[model samples]
Target: MGVEITTHVLDSPRHRTSYLSAGPPDGPLMFFVHGFPGLGAMWRPQLDHFAERGWHCVAPDMRGYGGSSVPTGAAAYAVAEVVDDMVELHDALGGRAAVWVGHDWGSEVVWSMAVRHAERCRAVVSLTVPYIPGGLTLEHLTPLVDRSLYPVEVFPLGQWEYMQLAIDEPELVAEEFAADLEATFAVVFRGGDPMTLGTPSFTSIVRAQGGWFGPSRRAPKMDRDETVLSEELLDTLVRAYGKTGFLGPHRWYANAGEELRAGRPGPGDSRVRPPVLFVHASWDPACETVTSRLAEPMREACDDLTEVVIDAGHWVALEKPGDVNAGIADWLGKTLRTGPHPM
Candidate 1:
């Protein structure tokens, strides 16, 4: 069934946000943040599920993507700025802190909020992306690199080559990518096989092969594989991203400087001492479990943290909505002392 959806645009540095809300009144607020190449609508499944449970579900089209303002400069898309926008959004909704949940880059922003603005977040759920402390940067993560998949010689820049492509020519990259949003979405969201970790690094293949879809730059047919993302859903994403282009979302990578990338504890670091939950995507390529090490630091930073592993791609909410909803409901019941509402 379709969920009640309400969305607004909040002006940030480069772009505005299409913030969508769902659920019943006086219910616990659950804030959602979408990842790269995704808009707030990505959480439709979760919104539908949670709203039935009488919870206020919110998903924002973070900084540069969707209906939000698309600022020209990369500096505007920093994690800090994104976090601040969320904080303001939460305040505007009500004074109370909501159950914060983020996916992909949005997950990174949620991590920042949990660390820097604990008071604003009652609980935290991060999908795909894990919390890396201030010290861990792309450089630091290089050592943990599975050399088998990504040979240092060829993929020296690691997964960063994609970022380079986006940063070097935002408009061209967007235009080139805009030609076939469906193909791009399909190719981009396709999760990597875990077994391949021991073989050639997929990141390397994409880089060495000159882009993800090979030299052609054309995305393949939209095949419903393990992702479970429906054609209607895929079309929604295509339309939203196709209109805005990826420049704003791509700029998020460039905006995250050493300070945000490092993830150093700022003034509000200790504030996220509440019950937190992290849903790790077993097959997420970007924040690959077998490749990227996120579990360790998350445990260290969050005094009360719950971790769940879902056999899905980076789009965990859509891929495993039942599991995701169950996890959230279970945590809310135990911690927030609430029960799921009937649809």
Candidate 2:
């Protein structure tokens, strides 16, 4: 709470993105991108820590989230459009090359930024989701699924079946989340579970169950998971989703096929030459990269890759902020060599 976060809007002809900023306006920039069902506030912990370390920190409410413009149509949420948002935001911030950090769908955006606009990125860090280089389509992702935990015979779609839910039954999935927004947020922001390792993640069964909550179409009532979210933070997220609804976020998945089709890579587009750090959530059963082949593409694509495994779930930054911050700090010190006590 050393520096208060200030809100600013980047308005463009195509879309409007709202963001939270802290630290000096002219300091080296650090942009934090949040995933689906999350706001710029999700990166509060990272923002505060990095800002204290003398970096200009900003986290944007990506298009279709929070106060940002929620454009209709799934195609509007494609990676190219989201990357364009980042490029424009960087330009609005004075065109300084900055370190980029992302989680979930945000990772996809930053990865694209590194590829499509490398000059704007000094370094990149990804949480939970790794850079897929070729783009993270079901066609590219399904092959990397761990068949042992999710056997092809029974769980044909693996942990990514939920993605299919968005494609095949978008309205139903959206209705289920909107049925009880608070409950949905409560369920989504829970801490990770190590006990579920090597097991089929609930995501793998979404299609088999007909939907996220099956016939009920609503998340089960539960208390907020304090390990991952304080009551204040949870309430903030619930309110944001309540106002914006889940259709825009879910549109990310609906456009996966199109993102893949339109995102065909040029020579070297898949490879990231900048210093890259990928933080793997060890307990993330859905995006299980620690014990699966999911991270292989990232390993091969990045020439300066440094991988760290945190014993937390998909919401690693929220559930274990200390470790996440420490990992990033350590990586930045060693790799970037521009910290206060640079090596």
The C-alpha stretches of model 2 lying farther than 4 A from their native spots are 257-264, 338-343
Which pairs clash inside model 2? none
Give the lDDT of residue 125 in candidate 1: 83
The TM-scores of all predictions, comma-separated, are: 0.86, 0.96
Which structure among the candidates has the greatest lDDT? 2
Candidate 1 C-alpha lDDT tens digits along 221-319: 776554656787788888787677877777776655334445556534534586887887777665666345545666666788777888876677877
Q: Worst lDDT window (10 residues) for model 2? A: 256-265
- Which portions of model 1 show Cα errors greater than 4 Å? 10-15, 157-161, 164-172, 191-197, 222-227, 257-272, 290-292, 337-343
Local distance difference test scores for all models: 0.70, 0.86
